[model samples]
Target: MATIREIRRRIRSIQSTAKITRAMEMIAASKMRRAQERDIASRPYADLMRQVLAGLAAQRQGDDDIHPLLVQRPVNRIILIHITPDRGLCGGLNANVNRMAVSFVLEQSVPVTIVAVGRKGRDFMVRYGREVRAEFTHLGDRPSVVDILPIARVVTDDYSAGLADGVYLCYAEFVTTMTQRPVIWRLLPVEPATIEARLEVGYIYEPSAASVLAELLPRFVEMQLYHAILESIASEQSARMVAMRAATDNANELIEDLT
Candidate 1:
């Protein structure tokens, strides 16, 4: 029911939108490559750290000798660390993660606290009336280990002090440049079985087993949190790139249909 002139004007508007999305897609693609590099580069160190800690845990005599980081406790207070993009135009990445966080809060039996590492998640949790214990953002596309330490410390300290019973980290796991899946991973109360599954066994420790664990266990925890941030950023960029391409495609299709 629209005139040809009106349709042509609409097409011009869509074309402009398509150009913006195209530019965004290119920028996101560039960032995604850098992020993937960082993720790949750090993976080996993290894996080796896990193996060393697992071997040390195995060397110990009894259950009580296990590191405090590996202890599982009753669910009294739950802490969720959510990693999301500070900005939008990333398709459903932010929405998907926030939905999971809200669902977790509603489903938990004990007190639930959210530690949001991105602005998007923080705003959503606060608007939805979910308890946000802590928030960090403005880390930019490329973040270093020191940037996320504050967030990691809060959960680690709470778990160590017996203030929080469990800790969960929510982020998107990278599959491919075009496909990313949101994942909820258990961060604290590291299970021996899980570690042992991937663990390389029968390694001699240089120092006392106790000393090795005392030092390495904390590093493993920090590395896990750091890598998680990388994964989140990569996934966000990938999702954004894919989404923008789709938008541009849809716009082009509409232009053709109108013509």
Candidate 2:
């Protein structure tokens, strides 16, 4: 048995909550659009860069002078660069990505260390008792290459120095407004796709193919990391927008029922 005054107060509280969620939905929508645009825009460049690296790798497939980054070695230890959102409220995006990483770590025979890129991933890894090599956070919605350079450096340096024999990157990839796929990509021992002889065009390198590849390998890693972050950001915003919209709808439904 509820009085009119109590019902009115509860309704007011729910309405206020609805207003907040509606505002969040709008904000997330705006961020989602921008994030999607940036993610899409970077794909072309990333693909082109991958093509060029593949061409270079194809040219020096069996050469002993191949870039260090392209050198494959026995698996000793594994490093996973796990990327997730800093905050929650994004449906199951964070959980999905974290679960994927956990599964990956469990499946691996070698000892796995994490390079956590966001607060959520870092906290999850720490709680799970995983050895976190490095933690990077506070990368806003619009992070540039400069912001991601340090992370790239850690992965590249560790791999080059033989600190880790294998490296992987895990992130939530933006597929659609309603879908975010958690994907794990091998980042070390750069496996470039072989190009057909007929498909390869003859182009002169600035100094030598080896020199160009040596310089390009690091840049390629940096670009891949930056692009992955962009995808994760887009996924985060999209999930948040959807989740907030749902929350607002639920609040409105509750308001109607109470009235």
Candidate 3:
């Protein structure tokens, strides 16, 4: 037993919080729609790019001169690009991605460094005593492919220069408004998806296959990274919207219970 005044005060505070969360839910819903559109729209192009890369990789199977990015060497040092949300109200989005990255790093025998793409991942990795090679944050709700080039350049330069042997990308993949999956995908050594020989169509490269590969490999890395970031954004917005909606509903339920 509580007095009438104390119960009234508690209800007021909860009502205020509910109002704020409702507003956030609306904002997140708006942003989620845009992010989902961008993420979905880019998937077809990414798939086609992978198919093209697979064909080019097949063409240079026996050649002595393979692109440096496509050369798979012994993994002595590994780089992980960990992407997460900067803010935390998105349920388990940050925790799920961070947990996946930590598990990956622990499982690797070689030295694993991180190129953190958001504040949450960077802070968690730094706190976990993992080596952070680079940090990128505040990329905003919508980012262009050009915005991701520097990140791609850093990893590509490191791999080409032998500073890193393998690169992995960790992010949340948006499936539906209620679902997001944490994924750790390989980014370096340029492993193109396997294609059947019968399905391959022979196309003439403008200059040479090697030359085309040289141009496309870096672009491929950039596109993959850009798409992953977009997926993470959409996932973050969806998770936040759902989380806030839950909070608002819980608050209302509590109010009714108290009354």
Task: State every prediction's TM-score relative to the real structure.
Answer: 0.90, 0.95, 0.93
lDDT of 1 at 189: 85
lDDT of each: 0.86, 0.90, 0.91
Candidate 3 lands at a TM-score of 0.93
Candidate 2's C-alpha lDDT? 0.90
Q: Give the TM-score of candidate 1.
A: 0.90
Candidate 1 lDDT over 145-172, as tens digits, reads 7777788789989898998989999888
Q: Which residue pairs overlap in candidate 2's backbone?
A: none
Where does candidate 1 stray beyond 4 Å?
A: 1-11, 61-65, 197-207
Best by TM-score: 2
lDDT of 2 by residue, 39-151 (tens): 67887777776777777888888897777788789998999999999999999999999999999999999999999999999999999999999999999999988999999
